[model samples]
Target: VSSIIVPITNVMNDQYCYQTSKKIRQVFDYKRRNGQYIGSNPPFGYVKDAKDRHHLVIDPDAAEIVRLIFSLLLKGTSKRGISFYLNEHGIPSPSVYKLEKGMTVSNKPDGNTLWSGRMIHTILTNPMYTGDLVQGRFRVKSYKVHQIETVPEEEWVRVADTHEAIIDKATFEKVQELLLRDTRTSPQGRTVHLFSGFLKCADCGRAVTRCSGKNNVYYACATYKSRSRNACTMHSISHARLEAAVLYAIRQQVHLAVSYSEVIAQINSAPIKKNQSFRLDDTIHAKERELAKVTRYKQSLYQDWKDGEITQQEYRDMKATYDRQINEVSDVLARLTAERAELANGVDKEHPALVAFKKYQNIDALSRELLIELVDHIKVYENGNISVKFKFADQLRRIAEYIDVNTAESPAWAV
Candidate 1:
C-alpha cells in the first residue's frame, strides 16, 4: 500500500508540471508572434521601454557604439580592428556596460572584460538594430528537459517595425552585402583596400587580384597573375590610375545626379507641367485599343476563309500578318501597362540614391564608405579601362527617362 501511494503521487506531480509548461509555452509563442520582446534583457543597443517591457527603445550610449561598429565596418575596417579600437578607446563591452548601469542581469563580466571580434560580428549581423523584433532564436529542448538549443533560423520569429531603428535598412543591407564579400585586410594595413572584393575581370570574369610592385600597386586578372596566363590576359591597372579613374567616374556621376535632381525639382515645381500618370494612362489606352483591333482582325480571318469570302492562302497570309501584329501590340501593351503601374505607384522624391549623392556632393577623395554606398562593382578591361556599375542604376535610369520625357531639352544622362 505504501509503494502504490508513493508511485501515484509521483505520477500526479509529473502530469501537473507538464500541463504548466505547456501553458507557459503557448503564452510565450503568442507574445513572440505579436512582436513582444520575451528575453530577460533587450539587445545591447536598446533598453526595454519603462512603460512596456515588451517594447525596446534605444539606449543612447550603447546605440552610439553599435552605430560606430557598423560605420567602421562600412569603412572597410575589420572586425578585429574595430574590437581593438574599442578596447583602446576604453569603451566598455556590452556585458560590463549593462552591469555598470545596474540593470538586472546575469553572468556579469568584470571591468577588464574586453570587446572581442566575435562581439562586433554579432552586433553587425543582428537584424534587431534595424527596428525589427527577432525572437525565438533559442529554445528549451522540451517542457520537461529544460536544456537550451538553438532554433533554426527559419523557425525564428521575426516581426518588422516594432521599435525605432538604430540603423537604417539600406545601410544595414549594405553591411550585410560587404560581409559576404572577400574583405581581406592588407597584411600591414588595419583596413581593407578601397576596391577590395569589387573588381572583376571583364574578359575572364574572374576576380582581379591585387599585386604590389616596387613603386606602385596594381590589380590584374587572378587567372592571368596566378592560375594560367593562357586563360586570360593581364587586365592590370595601377592603384593610382584606378583610383583616379574611379574618382573621376564618381564625380561625374555625382554631378549628373545633382543636375538630374535640379531638373526633377524644376519639373515638380512647375505650374503647367504635364500629369505623368495621365500621359501614361493615355498611352496605355491607345496600345490597348490597337491590340483589340488586331485581335479582332485575327479572329475575322477564320470566318472569312470558312465563308468563302477569301481564299485559304490569302486567309493564311492575313492570319499570319495579324498574328505578328497582335504579338507586337501585346509586347507594347505589356510595357505600357508596367509603366502605367509604375506611375500609379508614385516615384520616391527622396530616393536612396538621390539622398546619398546629395549627402556626398563634393567628392574630392574616395573612401570605403563612399564606394560601398555608391558603386556596385568595377569591371576591369584588359586595356587598363574600367566600367563602373554604380548602385541604384535602375532608379537612376528611371529618373533619366523621366527627365527626358518631361523636360524640353536633353537630359543629363542622354548627354
Candidate 2:
C-alpha cells in the first residue's frame, strides 16, 4: 500500500511541474513573438510584415508625407496643431495614403495614421531621424514573461546616417530640449492662455477659461459662462490684470531669492553638522521603507485578484483604496527625496526660477515660457483675494524652513 501511494504522489508531482513549465513556455513564446521587429535591413517607409521577415513597401507619396510630417514635428509644432493643419489642408494621413494606394486599410476616424502626441514624441525621439538607425531597444527576457525590458542606450545597435535628414541636427536637438522642458500648455481643444487650464474658479469649481472681449483676452468661469442662470457668478478676471499680478508675484519671489543668496551661500559654505546629516538620512530611509511597503501592498492586492481570491467588486474597491494611499505616500516620498537631495547637494544658491526670472526680468514683457516657468495659477478666490501661486513657492518655502532651522538669524527674504 505504501509503495503504491509513493508512486502515485511522484506521478502527480511530475505532472504538475510539466503543466507549470508548459504554461511558462507559452507565455515566454507569446512575449518573444509580440515585440516590434527591429532588423539590420532598413524598412524605410514601411512597417515590418506581420508573419514574413520582409519590409512591406509603403506608398511613395505617403512616405514623402511622413518625411514632411516629421520635418514639421521637429520644427516644434504641437501634435494637435499638426493634426488640425493636416486635416484642414485635406492632406491624406498614412492610413488614407495606404487606402488610396489600393491597400485595404481600416477606415476608423483615428486610424493607424492619426497625428497623436505619442506618435510625434516617438518620431522626435527616434535616433533614426539623426541618420542613426537604432533597433532592438526593447525585448522580452523569456517566452513566459509578459514584461518587456528596455535595453540600455550603450547596448543599442546604431547605424549612423542611415537615411536622408528630414530635420537638421540642431533643430532636432532644440526640439528635444523643448520636449524635455515643461513648457507645454493644454492640448489644442483647450484654450491657449498659459493660465487657462491651470486656474480654477473658486465659486464655480470649473476652469477659468479665456474669452475674447474688445480685442482683449479675459478669463471667465467656464461653468458660469455656459449655465449663467443656474451656476455661480462669472468671476471674470481680465487677462491683463491676471497676467500682471502673476508676473509681479513671480518678480517679487525672484527679488527675494536674489536678496537671500548671501544666506544661501553661507549655508552652503557651512559644515554639514552630524545631527543634521543623520536627520536627513533617517527621514529618507523611513520614507523609502514606507514607499516600498505601499508598493508591496498594491502588488499583493493585484496578485489576489489574479489568483481568483478576490471578487471583481472587492478587488476594485480595495485597489482604489490602495491606489489613493499609494499616491499620497508617493507624494510624501517625493518630497522627502527632494529634501534629502537638497541636504546632500547644498541647495543651489540661485534656484532655476530665480535664474529664469532674471533673464526675462529685463524684457519688461511676458512670453509663454516665462509665464509657464514662473507662475502656477492666478486664482480668483471667493473671499476676493486674488491668490497668485508662484511655481517655485514650495521650494521657496522649503528653503525658508531650512534657513530658519539651521541658522541663528532669520533669512530676511523668507516669505
Residue-level lDDT of model 2, residues 1-415, one tens digit each, is 9999999998899888778877975664454344323453333345435565422333355556656665554444555666766777788665555556565554544635555555545666766555445566776664346588998987665555544554566556655655554334444542233653457787766677777777887777778787674777777777788777776776676677776666777877888631144445567688778878877887888789889999888989988987888788788878877775675555567766456555554556565555545666667864434776676677776666566556654336532
Off by over 4 Å in 2: 1-191, 270-341, 350-358, 382-385, 409-415
**lDDT at 71, model 2:** 55
Assess each prediction's global lDDT (C-alpha) against the native: 0.85, 0.62
Tens-digit per-residue lDDT, 210-265, candidate 1:
99988889999999988997999999899999999999998888888888777878
Residue 103, candidate 2: how far off, in angstroms? 21
**Which 10-residue span in candidate 1 carries the lowest summed lDDT?**
272-281
Residue 42 local lDDT, model 2: 33
